[model samples]
Target: MKIRCLIIDDETLAHDVIESYIKEFPLIELVRKCNNAIEALEALQQEGNIQLLFLDIKMPGLSGINLLKSLPKAPDIIFTTAYPQHAVEGFELNAVDYLLKPFSFERFLLAVNKVRHKIELESRSAAAQGYFTVKADKRIHKLNFEDVTYMNSIGDYLKIFLKNGKVIITGETLKSIEESLPSNLFLRIHKSYIVAVSSILYIEGNQLVIAGASLPIGLKYKDQVIDRFA
Candidate 1:
């Protein structure tokens, strides 16, 4: 899969150089190039499938580092900047690599190679994994997809209910868990709840009955839920 990329920098020269380097690889697709973080934000809002970002730390207005922090689910980042001092901060933000300004095309390739490996690993894991792992009570827990009855969001974590009346509370967002689940087997009936399509016993109005628990279907999701189970 071609990695969809966005380049955010203030320098025209930087944009040209990065674009040139990216063009050498058929696996990289440069989606948009922005002169500042604000434009990058606009681009991100408009396009949800952007998988990678080439960001410059010291932009004119909102800095690239701040923009990354603000995103709810930021994509993989490679920080390209003149200031080597920002390397620590960039890595702290989980950037795949830091490219110093005046970097060689060879250096750019090395950085992107890391991104490609990361993408490959994520794709492999998502496609092959049958269970989700979580850290709870100072220990690791694995919840198999087949055992999951429903999932509910509780503040920063998710409360996952099992078919055998077991509950596992973990620091996982509903959105993240939903993305990991098989879409054919799980139906997101509400913003806060995702129920196993097979475990659903009945639907009472806008609520779904699963494993003897009633979960409300959000108004925005009601129609889709009904259509799926109808």
Candidate 2:
């Protein structure tokens, strides 16, 4: 499967450099080259199914960050810019990687390789049914199905507790994470909590004990929770 790429930069030289570098990797196919954000948007709509974007930050009209913000569903981005300050903002947007100007082909290959690995993992994950990947601490964290004891919602993040006394704090939402896990092996026993079916030690009134920790079973969820045990 080729990684269809789009180059959006005000500099023709930057486009040329990227195009030349990408030629070394036969798996990458250049889809289109656009001058500005608007052109990029147009190309995206017209081209459709672009998997990778090489976006430039300082263009004539809209900035790369702003352009990335505007897309409802964006492709994997590798920010190719002269400015180093926007690197933080780019990562916050979940870009695959950031490349400063005058970057080597080795560096370029490194970023694209990350995207390739990510794509392959996603494909494999969809087919296999054992673990799920979560992004945390500026890296991808893989959580095995049997290891996770429970998950608790902490503000905008989740505190995932494992059976081995490890806790992973991540930005993944409870609802989203719940949907990702196998329904047969996990249960949402509360609005803010999800527990592994095999981890529950016993039910104690409105709460269930799992791995020596007490987790509440919401009033609304009690019936279904009891039915699961029944």
Best by TM-score: 1
Top-scoring candidate (lDDT): 2
How does candidate 2 fare on TM-score?
0.56
lDDT of 1 by residue, 69-109 (tens): 99988889999999999899899989999999999989999
Displacement of the residue 133 alpha carbon in candidate 1, Å: 14
- Cα RMSD for candidate 1? 8.9
Candidate 2 achieves a global lDDT of: 0.85
Q: Rate the local accuracy (lDDT) of all candidates.
A: 0.83, 0.85
Q: In candidate 2, which residue pairs get closer than 3 Å at backbone N, Cα or C atoms, i.e. clash?
A: none
Summarize candidate 2's per-residue lDDT along 90-154 as a digit string, tens digits. Answer: 99999999999999999999999999988777646643778988878998899998899999987
